[model samples]
Target: MMEIVSSTVEIVIGLLVLIGALFSAFSAFGLLRLPDVYLRAHAATKSTTLGVLCVLSGAFFFFWYFDNYISARLLLGILFVFITAPIAGHLNGRAAYRTDVPLWEQSVQDELEPLLKGKKMKYEEKDMME
Candidate 1:
């Protein structure tokens, strides 16, 4: 009975892990399909996030259940990814914009320009602006 239960759990965990990998793969597809850096950022952000969660959750279940060890590191990694991924994505997208990366021509609005217009906040000296 114990062996049967362990096998079942393993199968389920494997499925979840596979799903997570597929989600991550979808992001790669988005990188090709999406136009411009910003749109691609959305795909990169979302798919990678879900993928990380899926893989981590699978690991957590497998270790904590079948192996009989509570998974602290898996939980911690999930927490870190949850906190950092979106922030990194936003930073990357913003950097792309600051460099004047082109947006899709069909885009209806640009919120970043108005945000940038508020004031000339100087992060560096005049020579840096050039």
Candidate 2:
């Protein structure tokens, strides 16, 4: 019975590792095939974050279960990624927009356009009156 249980655990661990690797591969593909900076950033941050998290979770389970030792470093790494990935992504996207990185042609709406336009208009009005 113990042997059977051990085999099952090994199989589960293998599956988790495989799934994480596949997600990471897909994330790479997305980064390559995406059309623009925003889309690429989305792939890198969103999918890569999930992929790394999955891989880390599998590693955590493997060490904790198989080795009978919980790894504080792994746990902390997981927590750090979960907390920081989205914030990093948001800041990158905002920076890209501020730098006037071109959006894809098919992108239909820009929520920032009016605000930017207003700022530009203020400068334009001042220059015209000078």
Candidate 3:
């Protein structure tokens, strides 16, 4: 019975690790092959977030099940991720947009365009002087 439980847990952990690995690898590939910064940012944010979540969940499972620790780190990690990941991704995308990185032709209604018009150089100069 112990053997069966251990084997099952191992299988589940291995599957999570494999999926995480695949997502991370795809993010790397997209970063290399994607034509533009915005698209690359999209891939990097989505895939890497998912990959990290999978890896974290696997860690949580391993610790909770194998070590029998009552510290629910997984729930904490999930909450942290849920709150921060989208914020970070949004910041990254916003940075890309502010830098005037061209979006794909299919992109609709770039609201940032007017916000940045005639102001990027001033900001750039201030940043450089700092």
Q: How does model 1 score by TM-score?
A: 0.78
lDDT of 2 by residue, 1-130 (tens): 9999888988887887788788889989998999998998898888888888888988998998889999999999999998899899889998999889999999999989988989978988999999
> Model 3, which residues run further than 4 Å from truth?
71-75, 104-130
TM-score of each: 0.78, 0.84, 0.72
Candidate 1 vs candidate 3: the lDDT winner is 1
Report the number of the highest-TM-score candidate.
2
- Candidate 1 residues lying further than 4 Å off, grouped into runs, are 1-11, 120-130
TM-score for candidate 3, please give it.
0.72
RMSD of each: 3.9, 2.6, 5.4
Taking the tens digit of each residue's C-alpha lDDT, what string does model 3 give over 75-113?
788778867877887898888776667788877777767
Count clashes in each candidate, considering only residues at least 3 apart in sequence or on different chains: 0, 0, 0
What is the total number of backbone clashes in candidate 3? 0
Best-to-worst ranking by lDDT: 1, 2, 3
Q: Give model 1's clash tally.
A: 0
Is candidate 1 or 2 superior in TM-score? Answer: 2
